[model samples]
Target chain A: MKSIKILERLLAAIPIMIGVAILVFLFVRLTPGDPVDLMMGSAGSVSQQEIQALQEEFDLDKPLHVQLYIFLKDVVRGDLGDSFTQREPVTDIIGRALPATIELAFGAAFFAVLFAIPIGVYSAVKQNSITDRLSMAFSFLGISMPAFWFGIILIIVFGVKLGWLPISGRLDYGFNFPSVTGLYLIDTVLARDWPALKNAVLHLILPSIALGMQLLAVLARVTRSSMLEVLRQDYVTLARAKGLREFIVIVKHALRNALIPTITVLGIQIGVLLGGNMIIETVFAWPGLGRLAVDSIFSRDFPLIQGVVMIYAFTYVIANLVVDVLYTYINPKITL
Target chain B: MLEIKNLAMAFETERGLVRAVNKVDLSVAEGEVMGIVGESGCGKSVTLLNILGLVPHPGKVLSGEIMFQGEDLLKKSKKEMRDIRGKDIAMIFQDPMTTLNPVFRIGEQIRESMRIHGLFKDVKGGFFKSARKHAEKDRAVELMEEVGIPSPETRYHNFPHEFSGGMQQRALIAIGLSCKPKLLLADEPTTALDVTIQAQILALMQKINQEHGAGIILVTHDLGVAAEFCHKIAVMYAGRIVEQGRTEQVMDNPHHPYTQGLLRSIPKMSSKKDRIEPIPGGVPDLAELKEECAFYPRCAKAHDKCLSQEVPMFDAGEGHTVRCYLYG
Candidate 1:
């Protein structure tokens, strides 16, 4: 039964992916700049015939309907075409940058969950205390501050001023570690190079914090409110009446019910973390998909932009699917 | 088994401090079923919560001595109180629908208290932890069967929502009886249930009392239920016990005007009276209560002297007491 439900959900995503494809295809075309003109404009003066030839070569000369048809056809056949500027297959470029983005996104999520839950639960349990007030104030500050601005502040304080961490790139220069999975941290661990692993972790700390600040703040507030509400539930009272320790009452009885809403927020925030990391990636000079996307947009690389967006849409669908599946496990009353 | 002396609890409300339970004193011997009868807002539930020290925030025990097995529960630390709760004195709440956690299976919740108090820790020593777990499950199933639930083995895996309201109450009672507590405090355990189910739950409680020999303090507004199930009855009015005695003594030969009014309010089968007589007024606001009789405004037999001084418990008959100026 569960498998059938999951399969149905996966089948329903097809139309959504197709809709994204059509929208992205038309939206990229509607933009002011033409990829052919931009590519040739930088090469000094060129003839109209030469421009027409380049346009035809890239299939930009076709009518909008015909172009959409061809694009959809190629997408179905697993072909994303070549970037107009980089002149490489869009899939190959995405493959190279995909690992870095996945690494950063998961790192930020890890940091957020590690700190947010405890902070949220503590604030709720000790509501209105000094620590609770202070943590809430900090979370408020985190939410109000922009990710890029936080990233710059972190760079200034931790990178330029104290020289405590690296400011740019995945690792310091001349650190040779075999790329097993393309994620520097995992690769370092796989190679069992402790110094490289340490350096990789140091590089990750600042960007992950900056990228995850808003998510952590939002998650903490959601967890706090959810927990506060669940603590008033009769089951929690019953648990306490059953002589369970306060810790067990809060964690075993209350936290699981509270996590239902928190998990929903987490699912939505992960999509935001992936899409909104563009500016943070640029600020931190991290070699990830967000930076690649920014570069592709500036050069009017339609295939590259389209490819990146499709991946993002696919990720969102999968994230929501995982959340729906998680509901069944967390609450028996909820079916797939 | 349990004794309460001068126990008072106050809540900080928007208007002012409301003493929810005031100077309430009662006692119950082992295996005895004591019923605290009162209307809504008369502090019956608060008095029960006070016994377990489980009152919600903004309300606190003002002054009290809850002696259980010769030790004042009020003097126990929070940890000590926790140790005593569920292990020595377990409590069941009103709404069975909301009392059990929805996410967990029935048997797991029943096993939780045993797990908390480490009930069977010495059976096979620490090494056979899995063996101890098996024993706990077996005991939980035994409890489920004892509570009159059908097919205990299969029902153990079901969640609270899967069970009917009566079955949920049974599961809750199973949890209450898991550790075999010496005293059970039930606050309107059958108010949310239908008449037949109410009778069934009360029968189950009576059985638990008879078999386990655990004292029970039941809070209810239905005098019929109290008369049917309890050995002694304490009638509360505005946070004070107005009359208390043997159930037959209080029900048949009630002394206080409030007790007489309560009895008259119950609809009878043989009496040709068209309508039952309801007490004239609602319970007085507990916050504004003065030293005079709280039932004075509602009592049909009120006199001037009843308002002149505070009324205290006066001996009405053998092992019976009534709080009234007339009795004084």
Candidate 2:
């Protein structure tokens, strides 16, 4: 039964990767730049002679399919090619950036779930009260205001005005924690450096908040509405009629049923996290794949752009697979 | 051993007040099965719910008290009510589909209240004594045995859905008997079963009465079923009991016009009761029936006195009471 579900989930992941490849391929072609312009420049300063030589050398002079085939071939061989601007391999740049982005995602997810579920549960349980109304109001505000604006407001208030912490950047000037693993939290803890750990967490705070606030609202509201519906099921009344305490009735009986719908909604919200990386990565100047993709798009760097989009697609497909497995865990009906 | 005094109930809905149960005074002797028989909307179920404290919210028991073993139930707090609810008084509800939790096994659901009320008293100091735990399981197994379940020991792990209708009722009976409650409020308990199962269940109830000596308040819409099972029968119409008497007396000498209609409606085996006339017209809405006996509109014997006010109970015979102007 478990294996069949896993097989379905594995099958479901294929389409997203196909979508990512298709989108990157078409969009890369749609944007007006070849490897010639990327290798040289748009201005007459580079001269036509140099641009022609560069295009031929990089196999950009070939047909679209051939160029695509060559790119795919190199990609399979772990060749991300060189970044003309950075004067380094695009692979190295993304490899360095991916860890920081992963750390932020984890930190944001932890805080959002921790804050949202309890608030949602409490609001649902205490419904129509001041706490419920206030929590709802906050959710609206979180979802409405743009992440960049929220990020800016957080920086102005906590960073510039109070002079408590740095406004941007991931770490202090000279503090070097050895990157045993790429995540800041793990490395900071390993180096036995409390202050770097503190600053790293602090730096992630505003951007993660800006990125995660919308999801928190979405998750909490979905949870509250779902719980309110589940509360009316006959099983819940039966549990109450069983002479169980109110806490047990709400927690054990109502919440478990409520979580099934909430899991589907949470999965969608987490999937939307990739969109946040676009705005958040640029705002904080955090070195991550989102910034790399944005930068690559502007330069029309095919290899780098394809790789970055693939990561987002890969993470998203895997998140959905995890959600399916999670649904099975919460409700046994979904199994084979 | 049970006396229900002047029970009144009203449901506060978005519309005005809807009277559900009203000023019902009833008594049940030790081991006697008293049935409140009525058509739907006659408040038969609500009166039993008022006795069991299972009436849904927004439907309030507006006045009166229920005295069980000479102690009034309305005075007890919700916590104290819990102590009496499933322990001292257990109920087998009408819909077998919903009475048991779908998620839990039959044995666990049945054993829950027993372990709550009976066995835990010995292990109250935050520690489980081996003998107390042993006794809890022993008593639960005995209850399943008493209910005549096939292979009670092996069937302990099965869920409610796994049981057939008759088996489910037996499981419910097992749960009801687990705490050895003083009163069993069975609201149409066998109404959902087939004829054969109904007979078996009725027989089981009689066996339970013989063995345990607990007062059983059986509610059913079927007059014949009531006559067969109950020691005393109360004929309710439009939220009031129009006639009540010992089963033999009520069956043989029904006085109220509505009772006469109901008795005649039953296709009886008795020779004199051959010409069956189905009761004409439906039960009048209790909430809309203003300033008169609720059943008067349909009562063939209703007069000017019936229109003026509600009829009070009049003694007709030995332990017989009929609420009608003709009887008065």
Candidate 3:
């Protein structure tokens, strides 16, 4: 029954994906810059014949409808076309960059959840205490502060000032390790390379923190308020009356009920992170899909841009689906 | 088995310190069923919570010694109180729909009390912890059966939402009886249930009391329920018990004006009166309560002395007592 529901949801994503593809195809074209102009702008002397020939080479001279039709036709056959700038297959580029973004996202999500739940539960349990007030204040700052700016500050303090960590990139330039998973963290672990794993972790800390700060803040506040409401419920009082330890009451009884809302925020955050943290990726100079998308946008690489957007849309659909499934586990009352 | 002496609980609200339960004195012996009846906010539920040491935050025990079994519950540390709760003294809350955690299976919740207190810890299962767990589960199923829940085996796996209101209450009773506590504190356990269901739940509780010999302190607003279910009745008004005695004695010969008004308010089936006389005026504001009788304004027998001084409980006869100037 659950699988059938999931299948129906998957089927529903088809039209949405097509709609996104159409919108992205048109929207990218609607942008001011032409790919031919962008590619030839750097060349000092460029003639109309050279531009026309380049346009013809990329099949960009075709009418908008004809181009859309060709693009849709090729997409139906599992082809995303090639990037206008890199002249590489869009799928190949995305596949290569995807693992990097996933690694960063995993790290950020890990950091967010690790700190958010405890902070939220504690603040709720000791409501109006000094610790609650201080944590809440910090969370407010976290939610409001810009991730890019925070990323910069972290780089300056941890990288430039203290010089305790690498300032940019995922790993040291000279340290060559075979890329098994492309996610350096896991690849290093799989290879039993401790030095590489340590280096990967060190590089991950600042970017992950900078990216995860806002999510952590939002999650903590949500968890705290949700927990506060749950704790006041009759069941909590009853759980206490049942002689269950405070820990069991809070964790097993209270936390599970409280997590429903937190899971919602977490799901949306995960979707956003998976879509790619464009600014954070740029700041850290991380080789992730967000950076790829940003570069493609600048170069008017329409196919690459469309591909990234499609992946993002797909990720959001899957994230929401996972959240819905998780709801059934967290609260039996909520049917899938 | 349980004796609460001068138990006064106050909630620190935004307005001020509002006395919720003031100078409440009550006791329940082994196998006795005591009912504390009052309108909403009269602190009947608070007194029950006070006994279990589960009064919510901002509600402080102003001055009290809830002596249970022999020791004062108020003097017990939080950890000690937890050990006593559900093991020696279990509580069945009102609104079964919300009392049981919705996420957990009904059987898991029923077994939770035993698991917490390690009821089957002595089971001989060296390197086989599943044997102890199995014993616990079997006991939970037995409790479910004892509470009259249909098909204890399958229903045990169902969540709270799956159960009907009556079934939920039954499950809650099952949870209360799981640990076989010496005392049970039922806070309006059947208030949310329908009339028929209420009677069934009450009967189930009475049976549990008879079989297990656990003393019960039931808090309720229904006078009829108190009359039918309790051996001893304590009627509360404005956070204080105005009258208490054997159920039949209080029912037949009420002393307090508030108690008389309450008795008059109950629609009698055999009476020719078209309308029951409701006690006029709402309960007094606890925060602004003066040193006079809290029910003075609403009392038909109010006098100069009733307004001038605080009233004390006067012995009427037998174990009967009433807090009124007329008695004084």
Candidate 3 per-residue lDDT, tens place, A1-336, comes to 999999999999989999999999999999998898888877657988999998987789999999999999888787899988888899999989888888899899999999999999999999999999999999999999999999999999999999988868788866667888788988888888899889989989898999999999999999999999999899999899988789989999999999999999999999999875999999999899899988999999999999999999988999999999999888899988
Q: Is the docking of candidate 1 incorrect, acceptable, medium or high quality?
A: high
Residue-wise C-alpha lDDT for candidate 2, range B148-267, written one tens digit per residue? 889887777776777888988888888878778778888898889999999998899989988899889999988878989899998887777778899988988988888888877877
List ranges where model 1 is wrong by over 4 Å.
A42-44, B125-128
Q: Write candidate 3's Cα lDDT for B1-328 as tens digits.
A: 7888998889999989899988989999999999998889999988888888888888899897888878999999988998988999999999999899999999999988998888998886746688888999999999999999999999989999999999999999999888899999999999999989999999999999899999999999999999999999999998999999999989899898888898999998999999999999998899998768999888787888988877899999898999987877
What is the CA-based DockQ of model 3?
A: 0.87
| Per-residue accuracy of model 2 over A1-336 as CA lDDT, tens digit each | 788878877787666566667678667777776655655655777877887777776667789888777766666576756665566776787788788788777667777888888888888888899999999999998889888898888888888898776667688687887888888888989999888899898888877787888878877898899888777665565455445666877887788778787788777767667534777888888877778778877877766777777777777777787888888667644643
DockQ of each: 0.85, 0.28, 0.87
Query: How far is B275's C-alpha from truth in model 1 (Å)?
Result: 2.9
The backbone clash count of each candidate, in order, is: 0, 0, 0
lDDT of 1 at B183: 97
Candidate 2 lDDT score at position A177: 77
Q: Could you tell which candidate, 2 or 3, scores higher by lDDT?
A: 3
- Kindly report which residue pairs in candidate 2 clash with one another: none
- lDDT digits (tens) for residues B80-100 of candidate 1: 999988999999999999999
